[model samples]
Target: MQNRGWLVFTLGVVGTLLALIGIFTVMEGQGLIQPRTIGLIFFFGTVALYAVVGLMVSARKVSDYYVAGRDIPAFYNGMAGAANWMSAASVIGMAGTIYLLGYDGLAYIMGWTGGYVLLALLIAPYVRKMRAYTVPDFMATRYEGNVARSVSVFAALAMNIVYLIPQFMGVGMIASRFLGLPFAWGVFVALAVILLTTFSGGMRGVTWVSVAQYLILLVAYLVPLVILSVRLTGNPIPWLAYGKALEQIDAYEVVHGMTRYVQPFTNMSRLNTLGLIFCLMVGTVGLPHVLTRFYTVKSVRDSRISVGWCLLFIILVYISAPAKAALVRNDIYQNLVGTPINQLPAWMDTWGKQGLVKVNDINGDGVLQFNELTLHADMIVVGAPEIAGMPYTVSSLIGAGGMAAAVSTSLGLLMVLAAGVAHDIYKKMINPNASEGVVLFWSRAVLVIVAVLCALAALTRPALIVQMVAWAFSIAAASFFPAVFLGIWWRRANAQGAVAGMITGLVVTIGYIILSHFYKIQFFGILTINAGLFGVPANFLVTYIVSMLTAEPSKEVQELVTELRFPRATRLIGEEG
Candidate 1:
């Protein structure tokens, strides 16, 4: 890498960190402000300002904006990409969602992580070899027809819209409930923040902003668990407390004295355990946004480091969550449940009125059951200060962390969505002769349009973060995983086969989800299944069958594939270097 690259990347990161400091120092509504409002504003405001700084520093070069001049380091790139891939959804939503779902939620964790392996082993290095700016660039180069181009465009669109919704919805949920503000206002605030980062700087600005997001997300999740774990289990490490947590979830019926909607997941059978983990882990490799992270890495090795760093950061929250969930559940049962209704913790009454928590005390037991608390699980973090008797200031800081995590991720997704529109479509397929400046203009322009669309989707909001995220993962698994993996390892793969496979897999997976979710099917006097259940096999089978039947790839595509598989050629590499 050249000094020019180093100067740009270092300057970029330091600038972002300074901006974060400045933003934090200036925060005014620290006490009266709800977590949602402060989080949404500060995160968006601070990062947007970073983007503006980044744009000013590098606006002279289109290449700098697109890929940081292609000199991003393996280690830092790994960190940046990991943070980019993980968002508010992972930091704020995953644990709470997992706590409620138990073993079922492991599927999301596995699916998200697994998608990156597919990127490293199958698609990323080869895509890098293609020397293209985005994922669609690979599709365009691989397939002979506009068919590949069209699929790439639609895939990027599908991945972006579905992924963006949860982010907006979450911000809306946090703002309206936490701040006592209208949900639409939360959506608008987040939109403004996202626009500041993406519209100003494109990928370069977004990258540094994500680094700040990662810090906020990790700290917010880690601190509470550390405090709870040491107090409850006499063990500072929460990941090791899975047995205790599972035992808690298992004993909910006894603890809360409510036997309804309480199943002993701890006693899950062997087959059930295998099925749950397998589905989640294998599905991880299929997510589009995760794969997109690899595009930012400078090399395949760097891509691998990014995944390793990602897993390291991800495990911080993943391991602690079950323990925290269990501890919180126990705390609720021991101190709050079975108490006089008004005697419940002050935090409960406060957040409960905000719809963050609710109590029926249906058994006349004067206790809130584990089942009774699932609806309120999302607010546990925000309510932790009052529940555990922490200082009010600390609680506000956590809120700030959560909002920052969410905004940073939304910004990353926002940038990716913009690139798909501008670089993938406007410059690549639509105008082959488009100048670098035209590309830069279209990229930022598209960034603005997508930001508005995502904010609107947040208005309706979804039922929960996990559901929307799961749906998106299922879509990616069916459409991308099979095709990309086969393309890399198999010799027989061709444009016809790859195209056939993607369409077949995507349609089967997405169509089934829509049908099963929206309406059930009637077939020959027998009712059959939810969509993802049947869709997975359909995607693989189509990819395999189509690849087998279609002619092998063109000579040029095959040679490119060979080159991608081999060590970098000194002659060619030096020439480029």
Candidate 2:
């Protein structure tokens, strides 16, 4: 009866939202609402909804705050997980990347999708079995020492903060473009909502809210693509119908004297592409924010099941990316290219004012050439409806969807950062006797501080959204992947070995990224994005060598590894230990 009621409520909310969107679209067509007003309503209306849900489900108990009382059903958990996983990079930057990079951008699709498979097969269920509150908690218990816990904490903070900055950048982009705020100020606007959603409900609030966000973002993403597809090829399904559009894009490139859109290895070296895919695959298993989602489910089996649902939801966005990219590119080629600068579409002026689209007319032709215009990767998805001459309401909805993607992921990353500091570091190491109230208080405190710091960093416009996210994946791959993987599979993996592995991997990967990205140091011709290629192997070697040289783990620790490998019952790993 309870489940049926919840189902009806969900359907009602979704139907109401769809009706509102339809009415708004009609209103915009009829000139009853201004474009700016529609954008504001769409963006803030969803944000207001998120705020309300956060307040309604705010966490009170420690368990609720950390793991959502371990009560999320598999289906909803999967929906929430999909929302949490599809950050701004996936939601906003991906289609833009495909538009810009052409064939090379498929690397992201392959890497991220394949990475989730690795997580599902090799990591999620085992992590759930451990039943630890945070990844560091699992490390400390598994390795029997604070050194391992502290190192894991550092890795989580480093990866998540790096990941978190791009999410804020996404928010800033959406707010600046849609809400008419300065980019820096826009970042803080999102910070307010993120803090409200996360500071109160913690994981519990984030989970339910993420389900709502997933629906909005998914709809916002697909609707524009489907409309564009039908307009271009008379097919409502973009994924299956975009092939002809791709051919048209290729022909346009040829006529414009540009590299073909389908040409592989034109933008990235083959080695770098493969290396990036490998790092992303391993990194998916290492990300603390993603692994924490599995901990919120009811059982290990549910955790595994949720991964399947997550992939289903995520792949819907992924498969549509190429279609969106191709159709948008075709639109630009057909409508904007060769037009006089002053005669270009209205979207050029709108996005140009925000510095997202630039036109130079380098050949003194007064007409825009493909080479003379530059489109920022972040703008492609959000600005697609405008580029295709769709209704203003469609573009407004895309802006709102982008906000949802950014907010949902931001909430998860914020929780991971807070738990790493407040739970793993403060309560466990500094003040083990602290009461739950004191701990929750500190968690909220850390959430604000970390969010403010990341927001400030986002104002600098560090890198493209996808590039920063890829860096996070690389860091996670290098530092956490080996430590966690070996700790679970190898009984001889002691605290000393785990600590050494994490430190070595983290130092090598970060050092390479800094040197290669800032100083132009060439490392076997590998791009900085693939720096994890060097770190993952180094960590594995160091860990293996160090573990072999050190005395083996005690019998109890060895037994725990055996139990993790072959669970005799549905008990927590801590209980068995």
Candidate 3:
């Protein structure tokens, strides 16, 4: 702990750099200068921010840098985690998804909100009490062996790489849209900027940076939606006003109103819609960066506070997303959806030029239908900024906000990336006695390597918004979440069982994802997100089956469990073993 000398200076510099980036991004978007100037601003802003933040916050002690001193207030940790988890998908994509899919998009809304609750109630406290700087640390002790830790490390690492793909792609897309640059350049620029900031801040800088970014994401999504909602319906409560089916209203009167358009929601059923929502809600608790935040808090109770805050921030965006989606869907249909194809709004015509807005004019009435917005389902939010008719400044602000969301989530993943390399693989097995300096160096190196690789993946447009991260969430749920929950709650859950469960889940998920990516399979009529619909069940079955066959853990493992249960009696001590 004494080795962490750079902590304070890093925070000051990173904070300053973020503010500058925000200012420059806004100014550049306002047309205050050239496109290249905006690029320069983002580049300088990220570099200076990371350099100062990194050099100041983390010294040679990996634990301090990785876990934020393990004395952070639950509220602060929760706030940071919220920013980290929201990402580009939440801030910029979810509402758009709903707009494209009608009420069916409620799946993301409920799932994200429900996830934090699950984390607070089911996973947070015991893991925080285990006192490991990372999730794999808990697995090692619960299993009473290195095998569980190894398995967990690999799982956590793989899931994170999967997680990072969409965010980089988002930032790139956003930059390309706002900065008037190529998508590849935007991706490279964001990657370089994040690599600099994350390599230095480690986890410590990330916590503060994330908190600031959370504030940005919430404001970005809510402010524009609020304005759009209030402008359309004299009411600020858009959710209630907009959430109705087109048939539920007086279609004739609404058609004549000339103010608000109607969305046809009669086709969306509750049962199927709710099922997907349930999967997301429960699956959310199992996400890696999400659960890792519990380790940053000072105590078990603090962990609960963090979950609450996370839920609260998410709600701010969650409520607004639906509101925005409904309003946009109606607004588009009322004004432009039915208009002559060439008579579409300037925004659509311009965006269509960029391949972002593709109107099908299905009836050849030159009218755009709700189904037309589903061209890819990912462009809803990005297209929303312009549809609201906000000035370029506000649109740029939203773009900046989206970038902040992407960056915040990216940093959190990068920290986990650093930890997987430094703590799990390196300290646990590679060279148990590697000096603090060497560990710290490797941490920075890991950040650089992972950021670049993720940047490469982003360039390829590898996966769409929800699908890319959704697969990662499913993995977390089936594998890590089950093991962590059962490890703490079930006394008979030995290292062997946990290992077997993780291996089963990991292998199944990889195979499923690969098959979906390289091969294809259809189940009944509806093809699955991947082959993994089968894997989740297989995971739970194998976990208990293996635990039954294996001998109970030695008394030492039981003793460790007891200690974990009594979080305060023995502070979650790390194994210096």
Candidate 4:
């Protein structure tokens, strides 16, 4: 009865908010509200809702802060996981990547989706059985010392800090473009809201808030997609109807002497494409923020069940992405490609003012050409509604969705970073006798400090959002994936091997990223984004050899691996505190 009542209340809140957004959208269309006014309303209104939920369910206990009391239902956990997985890169940059890279962008969809399969089948349930609060906590226990845990803490901080920058960048992009705020101010504004939402409830608050974010982002993404689909192909189903748009796009490409839209290996070599896919796939399983979702569920079974739910929720967005790319491309090719520079669509100028869309006439013909236009990949999805000439309300809704995606993922990443520092570093290593209150206070402090640092880094706009996210994935894949996989499966694995493997992976992957990206060094034709292809193999080989050389783990540790493999209603390893 209690669960049902909570469900009813959640539905009521979501329904009421959706209805309000719909009314405002119509009002904006009818000129009853200014676009800026509605944009502000959508942005702050959603943030305020998340803040209220956080405060209402604020975490008071250590367990609640770390793992949400381990009582979250599978379905909601799945929803939260999906929202957490759909970072700003997935929400704002994915469709834009599809737009810019054409068929090459499908590598991301395939890699990310395939990674979940690995998580569900091989990782999530076992990790849940371990009952560890953070991945570093699991490492410390599994490897039987602080050494492995401390190394994992370093890797977690590095990867998550890199990941956080892009999320802040997405928030800044939305605020600057939609709310008319300066980019730097926009990042800090969103940071303040994020800190407020996360500072109180920790994972407990973030879990429920993520569920809400998933709903908003999903609706915001699909509404404009369906509308554009109907406009272009007279079909409401974008996934099926987008083939018509693709046909038109292909013909336009042929006529304009551009690369075929459906063709692969145009921009990147085949080997680089395959390597990128591999990195993304393995990296998905290695991500601490994503894997932490499993820890919040009721049991190992719920953890497995939630993976299924997460994949289902994620597929809805992934499949629609190609259709959005096709439809938007078709619209641009048909309507905007050959227009006079002075007569270009108003949306072009709007996005141009933000430095997202650029047009240059190399021939000085005073007309736009396909070759002269450069649209930043991040702008494609956010600007799609305006590009389609949809109502300002639709564009505003996308901004809200973009913010939701950025904020939801940021919260999860922040939790991982804070927990890594507070639980793994401070309490476990620095001050083992510290009280619960002290640990929690430091956790909240770390959240603020880390967020501010990332926001400042985001102001530099270091790289494209998706590129930075891929770099994070590469780091995680190299450092965490092998250690966790070996720790769970191999009885011979010890603290020495795990630490050695993690260090090697981090060194190799980070080195490759720096050399290949900055110094333009080439290695087997693999792109910098897929540096994990080199690192994963190196880690696995080093770990296997090192474990064989080192003393085997204790008999007790072997028994723990057996327990993780065959789950039952047994007491978890770390539950006793």
Candidate 5:
């Protein structure tokens, strides 16, 4: 691990950067600078900061490009992991989902956090000890077959591309809404920022930039909650203020005849809640971007510590999310429920411009009835400052924070995709003797290509961003979790079994999702979101049944598994065969 000096220095740099942005924001509000310019400067300037750092720390060697030379300290890796884990879904969509579904949405929180616990206990140490550069690296070595590697690589790429679409699209959406830029410009900016930083530094660059992003996003997310909490309950701490705020909300609900917002399980079935939580938890363990972080640390012990820190940082954000949802829901009801449509707050009008908040009088009444107001799940975070009457400066900070969350995750997934192509596919299977420089060059090339492809996809304005994010998780859980778990723990697991299991899991999960999502066909009247439930069991059964029916693994494959079972006995890339 490096000295603690860098930690202190980095914090100082972040503090200075934020202080300058804050000052510029005030000046803009006071007519010293153009509002749009300040927004652009602050938002993209943060990206520039990351780009400079990434260029400075970027890898010259294949090892560094792939895994940051395996020298990242646990603390820094933890921060990076948190930033990676909390994608646009967590930052922008989580609060919105909670606001829409009330207690039922808490499943996302429980499942995501609980999955980290599972990661720490069941997965991280072994993967770190195995010392694989990519998820497929571990898969190929353990299963002792090129076929296993190819399947794992394809799954990683598919899941990652699906994941990246929403994040990049979020960048464009946030930029358009917050900076008054066109959506394409927003996406171009995101692509440029990602290419400049991640393409330059690779995993090393992503690691440090993610640490900076964690700071920006958390502060941006927490600031509005703190101010609103003080206004609602005379406390700045959001969690502490939630109970009192809920009381006020309940009373407001009674006055307005609102039931779904206050009642638990009113918006979704409890079975769906269980299903969502289960999928997200297992999905967390299965996610390549999250698991890849473990491979970047200095030691297996550091990897474990990194998970602990990840949970700590993630929990802080997760707990505050419910507070944001409750406060925003209450604020809207108390302030806008009975106001005349013509006299509503400017924030409502501005947000309405984006079609995020809809106000209509279904009964032909002039008053804005509670039932007449419709809030999209995203408005809770994006329009939060305006809802609370905060300054445009704070709103700008929130926009930047949203960008941080989106860009940080996009950078990580882009790396995963690039590595999947350049390292896993090209060098491993195509040119086993490829030079390190050639591999690094292809990795950088793929990074730019992916950014462009994802940008084009983002321009389609996919309505399924959040749903796709969940789909990514569910797919990852179904396809990778069982194979990975069995490969590490069960010696009888063979290449044939893994191949069958992964293919079955992917088909089952995707098949169920297509039928339910496109056709609304419920299985045996089960309308709940249990696609993962069907896929996961089928995976285990097929893998076990197929492996037993086929030949057992070679002695070398068994030896590799035994080696991975202990941290100290293993070396990096412990491929016995």
Candidate 6:
């Protein structure tokens, strides 16, 4: 009910923002205004709007702060989930990979989108039925051991921080590029927006803000594609127009005597592709921030329906990403491939200044050959509007969308991490008699501290955006997925087995990733495979064998699992000693 008013206000504000941006574009194009100035206005304007909303819906009660009082409807929860799941990696990274790798890049789309199906079937319903505020709470309660909960809390914090810092960096980078500000200043802006929105309302505010973000980002991504599609093939649907563009690209590649862009296994091996897919699919079910979304809905039924809606929203962008990539690739080949370096389009000059696109006369031929140019894939989506000769405002919109994706996911991850500390460990183990006011105060305090720390870490310039994400998912898949899946379905899964499984999966995956990424070492050549590949199986084997070797979970724990597994019978909330 509270969201209805917020929804109406958001619609009006977003519409006004879009209209103003269009006007600014017209002015800049006609030489009446500067595009960078317009960009600054739009960037700060949108972020300020979110800050205002956060303050407006700020919560007082612990229930409202933590899980929005568990009152969110199925549809809105789905939208928020979609927004939370589709982080900067999904918005910027996927299209960029598709642009660079062609057929090989489709793996990201397949793995990420397909993971929702697994969430719908395997995890969402049962997790929601548990009625816990955080994943560690469920893991601790289900296993009947605070030790298990403590392990989960540490794991959740590690994974989420690794994930969260990159998003913070992304937000900073996007703002810096668009407004021509220092990267640190852009990071400060991001920190301000995050603290304002998240600190004000907690989950209650974040859920609605996520809905607004999803709408803004989806529109920003789609508008340019539709325009480019119509220009290339007289079709407004980008994916459908991709068919026409693909034929043209293939012909152009033949004329240029280049490798076909549509060929499979061109960028990565078949084994790596399939391994990546498996990691992503299994990884989705385990992400603390993502799985936490199921807790916001009112019932188990809502949780299931929400996953369906989340997938629907995600597919809209997933299917379009490849098509957008193909069109951009074709556009470059058709127009810029044979042009002399100095005579290339303005976009080339613009992005080249940023080091995103490089051109060299490798053969001393003075012309920009297809093979002579190297592009960073992140440019594909961010530079697409400019590549298509759209107004500068469209490019600005893309930047805003990228920021939205980064901040929304960061907000969600930050919340779960705070809950892991304040609720799971602090209240549960450190001070069981802590009052609601004390718990709420510490939770908000932890939330703000986490945001600030992540923002500062973002300035440290960590790993590549997409690579850091892969590590996070691999960790989740290796550590959390096996324990979560087996604990609910296998009655013999004792607390000892669950804890041991988590440790095995986590150590194997993280250790392999460290060796492969940092030391460039591939132990026995197996570490070169997806890190989750080894970790997941190790978890299953160790957990199953250990549980079989040990005693079953206590009768009460077994009965609790049965109740959660089948929602037709009894209900439990909070937890029993």
Best by lDDT: 4
TM-score for all predictions? 0.83, 0.95, 0.86, 0.96, 0.95, 0.95
Tens digits of per-residue lDDT for model 3, 1-577 = 4223334433554465447545665766677766555544543444464456556665345677878777666556676777888888888778777766665677678777876776777778888887877788888877876888888888888888888989899888876766678999989878876776676556777776676666656656665666677776666766666655244323633655632233333334454355455556656776767777878877787877878887886787778777777676667556655566666668777776777777775666655555455334556665665677764545655676788888888888878878877888898789999987888888778888888888998889876777787777767766787788788778788777778888888788777777766577544322234334555677778888889898988887777777776657664558845
* lDDT digits (tens) for residues 445-524 of candidate 6: 88888788888998997787887887788888888898888877777888888899999998888888888888899754
Alpha carbon lDDT of residue 205, candidate 3? 73
RMSD of each: 5.4, 2.8, 5.5, 3.2, 3.0, 3.1
What is the full ranking by lDDT, best candidate first?
Answer: 4, 2, 6, 5, 3, 1
Worst 10 residues of 5 by lDDT: 524-533
- Computed on alpha carbons, the lDDT of every model, listed in order, comes to 0.62, 0.87, 0.70, 0.88, 0.84, 0.84
* CA displacement after TM-score superposition, residue 396 of candidate 5 (Å): 0.8
CA deviation > 4 Å runs, candidate 6: 1-10, 255-257, 523-529, 571-577
Q: What is candidate 5's local distance difference test score?
A: 0.84
lDDT tens digits, residue span 89-117, model 5: 89999999998888888988999899988
**Which residue pairs in model 3 clash with each other?**
6-56, 6-57, 7-56, 7-57, 10-53, 10-56, 54-200, 143-495, 337-368
lDDT of 2 at 239: 84
The TM-score of candidate 2 is: 0.95
Better of 1 and 3 by TM-score: 3
Number of the candidate with higher lDDT, 1 or 3: 3
Candidate 2 lDDT over residue span 1-577, tens digit each? 6456456746765776789789988888888988888888888889888988888888889889999999887878888888999999998889899898888889898988898888887888888888899999999988897889999999998998999999999888788877778888899898887887886688888887898898899889988888999887898988888888888888877876889989998888889878878988898888898899999988888888989998898999999998899888887888788899879888889889879899998999799988899999888888888787789889888888888999999998899889999999999999999999999989888889999999999999877778789889999999988888888878889887888889999999999989988899977899888889988999999988888899898888887777676433533445543
- CA shift at 428, candidate 3, in angstroms? 1.9
lDDT of 6: 0.84
Q: How far is candidate 5 from the true structure (C-alpha RMSD, Å)?
A: 3.0
lDDT of 1 at 342: 57
